[model samples]
Target: MDAAEALTLLMSPQGRVDPYPTYERLREHGPVVQALPGLYVVTGYAEADELLRDPRLGVLDDALRDQVWPNWRESPAVSSIARSMLRTNPPDHSRMRRLAAGAFSPRRIAGMRDVVRAQAEELLDGMRDRAGDGAPVDVLADFAYPLPVGVICALLGVPATDRPLFRRWAGDLTGVLEPEITVEELAVADAGAAELRAYFAELVAARRRTPADDLTTALVQVHDTDGERLTGDELLANLVVLLVAGFETTTNLLGNGLVVLLRHPGAAAALRADPGLAPAYVEELLRYDSPVQLTTRTTTAPVRCGGLDLPAGSTALLLLGAANRDPRRFPDPQRFDPTRDQAHPLSFGAGPHYCLGAGLARLEAQLAFPLLLRRLPELALAGTPRHRTRLTLRGYQTLPVTLGTPAVADRGTPAGAHPGTP
Candidate 1:
């Protein structure tokens, strides 16, 4: 299949289910190929890396939206995304990113390491109990979903009780990120975005009234040297971005990582034995099956890339998943090797728009994976995992797994303790 055919297939639901083959077909055409009028697709690692960092290629924001689709802002879902730092260019992006950076500092992320491990252990214990009943546990619900949500909530000073609500809203809102969402989905996304905005507005106000040692409080009080800071709308939009972006991608990462680990028993065993290998293991997991499949950027000016000189305002869809698996970049790209040297996948992207929460996500996964494997040594796939029907953010909707057997007796015995004695 040519690039056009491949892109067509990729936009289809079936193609989203498994787009690797389509990516391979597109890559055969060239690193970068125009799939449609004024739209290019980058399937090679080098091209994607370069384009992601290119100043000429920028996020398609409201200004660009006006140029492309006259009625773009008519959709609330689209407008909400447009306001986010995720889709903004330099000045606005830089300001928003700088304000949010304080909360996600290395110090803060390191402080949360213990918190993540604790959450992981508690969830694993619950999974253990569920497995004791001889019923399969949905890992997505029991473990992957809750762990990241809890961590992000704590970071954002969101009450733990509101987790279920966040999960529901996040689910609806994330559909907006997909390329081919239905009208019904768009309606739901609109409602979700409005509700989320209102929720954060209240939260931000409360933070101002009584500041706490959390990310939200920091954001509310943060100001630049010249007393510049996030305006009300900027604050609301970015807060929504933080809350949703915080857990959504990490949830997918954990889910995808577990699936990969379960499929590769040797890797799982290795991780279980030496938890210290988690950092490297997590990197490999990310590269092997990235949580995010693709991201887009538009040309700000006429620029040459991949031996092609394109006109201004051209859209380039960077296929991150394909780039991660590009043979030229990664030797034996398909293989899952935890000890792979210098594995720097574009899963979190690159340059200015690189995921701000990348470090936190890495910390959570690094801690959670080790804790999980150690606690649930017998974990195994109970049934076929169901991947969420999201092309952009790829992860399991329901990952059914059996925790094998309870590592501890039900009679209030600690794990690894002698049941009869203790």
Candidate 2:
């Protein structure tokens, strides 16, 4: 397939199902290609790395959107998120990120290890109860989904009762980030964003009235020596973004990690036997099949990228999934090896906007995987796994498995199973 054709297919359903081959084709032409007028696609490892850290490139902020897609803010979901650090440029992004970073201190992250272990054990217990008598249970529905959700909610001080509601809102709201979205999807996303805005407004107000020992309360009080900090709107928008971002990526990681472990019995055995091996295993999973496939950036000025001197006003689609597997950067990319001393994956991205929850996401997976293997020896795929339709934010929609260790499961051969490598 040619570069343009491969790029087109990457956004198609078939491509979303498995884009690695398409990425190979796209990378063949070069690291970067002008997919269309005003749009460039970057698939090469070196080029993607250069562009991510390039100060000339930035997210599609409000001013940039107005100049390009003027009606972009017509959708409430779009407008609301655009106000947050995720979509804003330097000054605003730096200010908000500083406040949020304080809440995500190294000490705080280190302390979450115990919390993650507890949550993972609790979810596994629930999964075992549901899968009693050898009945099948969806890892996505029972374990993978709730584990990260519960962790993020606990950090944010969100009530347990309100935890279930986030799944629907996050699903609806996150779709707006995709390049392709129908009117129906956009409507749902708008409603979700509105609901989130209202909910956080009250929650933040509540925190002000009665402070708590949680991330939200920490953010509410965090400030610089000059007393500069997140404004009310920034606080609301960021809180909503944090909840959605925190869980979605980790959920995908857990679901994807589980399948790979099931497929590669050697790796699974190693991880199960040596708990210390989890850090490498989880990092390798991020490279092999990244939860976040792509991210976009627009040029603040004429910038040299992908062996081309593109003009200002150009937008580049950084194919991070492809870059992670680049042959030059990683030899034998397709084969998943936890022991391969390899470069870091662009899965959490790079530069100033690197994922804020990246540490926590990694922590969640590293703790959850070994427990999953040990706690449920019989856990094996019960049926063909299904992935979510959305391509931009990829993950399992459902992963059915039986708790009664299917015959020969230890050898990576289980009932109703497919190849473990995604």
Question: What is the TM-score of each predicted model, taking all chains together?
Answer: 0.93, 0.92
Q: Can you give the lDDT of residue 85 in candidate 2?
A: 88
- Superposing all C-alpha atoms, what RMSD in Å does each candidate have to the true structure? 4.3, 5.3
Candidate 1 lDDT tens digits, 192-247 = 98889888878888887898988788777763223356766677778888888888
Listed per model in order, the count of residue pairs whose N, CA or C atoms clash below 3 Å is: 0, 1
| Candidate 2 structure quality by residue, lDDT tens digits, 217-302 | 88777621233567666777888999999898898999988998999988898776666677889999999989999999999899
Q: Give the TM-score of candidate 2.
A: 0.92
Top candidate by TM-score? 1
The segments of candidate 2 whose C-alpha lies over 4 angstroms from its true place after superposition are 221-228, 405-422
